[model samples]
Target: MMTTIAAAVAAVALASCAGPGSAADDAGERTLTVYAAASLTGTFEQIAADFEAAHEGVSVELSFAGSSDLVAQIQQGAPADVLASADTANMDKLVDDGLLAGRPADFASNTLTIAVPPGNPAGIASLADLAGDDVQLVVCAPEVPCGAATERVEQAAGLTFAPVSEEQSVTDVLNKVTTGEADAGLVYVTDVRGAGDRVEGIEFPESGSAVNVYPIAALGGSEEPELAQEFIDAVLGADGQRVLTDAGFAAP
Candidate 1:
C-alpha cells in the first residue's frame, strides 16, 4: 500500500509540472495565430471562440490592426499563422511577396458610411456635410482601406472633405465619433452597425462606388499550417459567413 501511494503522488507531481493550467492539459496544444484587419474584430472574436469549442486543444490568438499595418507587420517577420485583410489590395501585397501558402479567398465585402454621435448632434445627413468647415470630421489615413474607399466616394461624388483627424484604423475613427471627440467619422457600414446606438450611421449614394472586398489566407511559414488552413476554411464556410453577415458584412 505504501509503495502504490508513493507512485500515485509522483505521477501527480509530474502531471502538475506538465502545464501552466490543468495537470491533464497537453503542453503541445496548438495556438493558431491570426493577424486580421481591425474591422473584423467583433466577428473574428466570435469565430475564434467557436473555433476553440469545435477544435479541442487549439486556441486562436488574434492581432487586429489596419490592413496595411498588418501587412507591414507580416512583411517584417511577425509570427502569424493566418492573415485576413479588409481589402484585396493589402492581401495582394502579401500574396505577391509569396507570403501566403495558398490563394487568398475573398470572404466578405463592406462599404463606407458616416458615423455620427447619438442624435447626430451635428445634423450630418449627407457626404457633403463632412466637408463643412465647422464640422469636426475624423477619418482613417489615406493609405488605409477605409480611407481609400472614402477617397473613391469623394471622387465619385465630386466633393472633398478636410477631416480634423486621420486615424490609423477604422476603429479609431469610430472611437473618436463615439467619444464625442469628433462630430462625424468615415468608417465601414459594418462598423456603424457594430457600434449599436453609440453612433448613428448615414448612408450616401457615393459609398457604392468603392466597396472593399475582404480576404483571408494561411501564411506560408505558419508553424501549424494545417490548423491555419482549417481556420480559414471555418471563416469562409457557412457558420462563419452567418456570423459575419449578422454583423453587417456582405457576402463576397
Candidate 2:
C-alpha cells in the first residue's frame, strides 16, 4: 500500500518497473519509494532505472519536491524507502529527529548560478547585474537549499537582490526564466545545464561561497529496509557517481 503526502503540497511521483525477491508484496511485486530533492530529478531518475534493472520484480517510485518539503512529509509519516536531500541542513533535521535508519552519505555537490532567458534578454552578465531594479529576478525561497546558497552568495558578493518572486524549488525558478516570466533566476548549475537551451546560464565567482552537498539515506520508518539500503548503495556507487557527474553535479 503506497501512502501519498497531502494534496496541498503534492509531490510528483514517477514509477519505473523491474524485478524483486522474497520481499515482494503478495502480488509478487515490491515498490521502492524514494523521496528526492527537485534538483536531483534528472539524475535520480536515471539512477532509479539502473537500480530497477539490477533488482528484478521491483518498481521504483520517485517523488520530487523541495528538500524541506520532502523532510516534512517523511516526518509526517509519509511512506518512503529512501530520502536524498539537496542539502545536509534539511537532512540534519531528520537526524535530529532520529528518523534515519543509518548515517547519511554525501554523494554530490552543486553551486548556484544565474539563469537568464535565451539571448541574454536582461544582459545579466554578473551577480551584481541582478541587483538592478530593472531586472526581474526570481529565486528559491530562503528556506530552500538553493535559497540558502543564494543568501551565502549575496553575503560573499556583498550584493542584495530584490527578487520579483521567490519559488519553492529551483525548477520553479528555472521555469520562470524559461517562460520569460522573469528576466533571470537564481538556480543550480546543474539545473541550468539540464534545461538545455531553454535558458542560458551565467556563472559567478560568488557561487563558490555556498556550495550545497547532496546526501542520501534510508528512512527509519521504511518498510523495505534492505531494499532502501540497496538503493542508497547504488547512489553511492560508481555508476551513480558517473550519472551525477555527467549531470553537472560535483562529486562530494
Candidate 3:
C-alpha cells in the first residue's frame, strides 16, 4: 500500500513539473499581421486598436504600403493574415491567381483631390490650373491605385499635366505638397484628412468619374484566418464604416 501511494505521489510531482496552463496560454497569445494600403493607415490603426482592446491575448501588427506593392509581396509569399487594397483591380488579380481565401468585399470608396499647401500659395484653384507652366504637379505612378484613378480623371477631363514627379503612393504626393516640393498633387480625400492641416484639399468635378473602391480579404495561406476575418468584418461593419466615413471615405 505504501509503494502504491508513493507511485501516486510521483505522478502528481511529474504533473506539477509539467507547468500549469503553459501550453494553453502560449496557444492563446498569437500575433496577427495585416498588410494594408498606405491610405488606410489612419483608419485601420484605429480599428486595430479597437480590436486589440476587445480581444484578450492577441496582438496586431500592421504593414502599410502601396496596394500594388503589398499585392506583390503577398504573391511572393510574404506572411500576412489580411490584405486591404485601395482598389479592387489588385485584389481581383490575387483572386484570379487563387491567392486569396474568398471573394474580397468592397469595404470603402475614395475620390481623388488636388492637395496644395495651406493658403494656396500658388493661387491654384481647379484641375485646369495644374496644367499651367508655373504649377509643379506631383502625381502617383500609373501602377498605384491613386495614379490610375488620376489617369482616368485626367482623361475624362481631356486635360494634360506635366507632373514634376510620379510618386509611388498617394501619401507621397501629399508629402510633396506639404513640404513644398511641388505646387500641387493629386491625392485622395482620405489622405488630405489624414494630413491634418498640412495641406488643403481641392475637389474637382472630374474626380467624380474615377472613384476608387477599397477591397479587403483574407489570404489563403494566412496563419490567423479567424483574426483576419474579424478585421475584415470590422472594416465592413457599421462601426468600421462610421470610422471610414468620418475620415472622408465614401460608403461602398
List model 2 lDDT by residue over 1-252, tens digit each. Answer: 134455323432221232343222447678999999999999999999999999887999999999999999999999998999999999999999999999999999999999999999778899999999899999999889999999999989899889999999999999999999999999999999999999999999888899999999999988899999999989999999999999999988
Poorest 10 consecutive residues of model 3 by lDDT? 19-28
* Candidate 2 ranges beyond 4 A from true positions: 1-26
lDDT of model 3 at position 40:
90
Using TM-score, give the best candidate's number. Answer: 1
The TM-score, computed over Cα atoms with residue i paired to residue i, of candidate 2 is 0.90
Q: RMSD, each candidate, Å?
A: 3.0, 10.9, 3.7
Candidate models: Cα lDDT each: 0.93, 0.92, 0.90
User: Which regions of candidate 3 deviate over 4 angstroms?
Assistant: 1-27
Q: Of 1 and 2, which scores higher on lDDT?
A: 1
Among residues 3 or more apart in sequence or in different chains, the pairs in candidate 2 whose N, CA or C atoms overlap within 3 Å are 19-56, 19-57, 19-58, 20-56, 20-57, 20-58
If both were scored by TM-score, which would come out higher, candidate 1 or candidate 3?
1
Residues 1-252, candidate 1, lDDT per residue (tens digit)? 999999999998887677556745766688999999999999999999999999988989999999999999999998999999999999999989999999999999999999999999899999998889899999999889998998899889988889989999999999999999999999999999999989999999889899999999999989999999899999999999999999999987
